[model samples]
Target: MVFELRPASSADLCFARELTRETMLRYYIQHDLRWQDEAFDVAWAGRENWLICQGDSVLGFLSLSRDAKALYIRELHVIKTDRCKGAGSWAIEQVFSMAREERRSSLRLTVFKNNPAQVLYQRMGLSVVGEEDCFLRMERMCSAAP
Candidate 1:
């Protein structure tokens, strides 16, 4: 399916919050992790937040930030119904392109160790760079643009 990333606005805050809460709750529950509602926030106004869209429908959203060293993926969430339909992969590819355009040497993210998405990251050529009690830090070296 065709998907695009659009900058998320204040108008999209509620949808982003609800989508994140729901998806994260399921993820936490399945992994036997604690869910703290107080700690949950979509940060919709963040400059790097983007809504994953197909036409008028908002399928999911991702939040990314960059420094001179690397592009970091702060969050990536696709509604449960939309998972496995290619939206997540599409979004990551867009981020990869963005990192290359910015001349970032690498893309980095932390994924819950038990989250199945870690497998997807591996498939995308990211390697484990470090690990925390609950998360695995992964990085992919971005090739220079041709």
Candidate 2:
């Protein structure tokens, strides 16, 4: 299926916020971490948020930020209904493309070790560069070819 992305606006906040909380709450609990209710809003203020769309349907959202070394993927959550349909892969590709355009050297993100999505990140060429208590930091150096 063809996928597209539009920059998320304040009007999209409710959908994106709930999507993130519902999808990520379990990982926080499983790891004994606090799930801050204001996390999404705080992140939205500083990141580039995008709504994943298949035609008119909003499938999910991803938030990206940049550090001196890499473009960081702060959050990525796809609706349960669209989980296996390549939306996540496409979203990663979007970040890669942005990294290329922005002349960023790498893509970085942190994922819970138990989160199955880490497998997808590795598949997309990101490797674990470091580890925190319960999260694995992953990175993929930018390349001319994806």
The digit string of per-residue lDDT tens for model 2 on 1-146 reads 99998999988888988998899889888988887768768878888899999999999999999977689999899999999899999999999999987888999999998999999999999999999999999999995444
- Candidate 2 runs further than 4 Å off: 144-146
Instruction: Report lDDT (CA) for all predictions.
Output: 0.83, 0.90
Best by TM-score: 2
- Candidate 1 residues lying further than 4 Å off, grouped into runs, are 26-44
TM-score of 2: 0.95
Q: Which candidate number maximizes lDDT?
A: 2
- The C-alpha RMSD of each candidate to the native structure, in angstroms, is 2.1, 1.6
lDDT by residue (tens digit), candidate 1, 35-84: 66445453444447899999998899898888887999888999888889
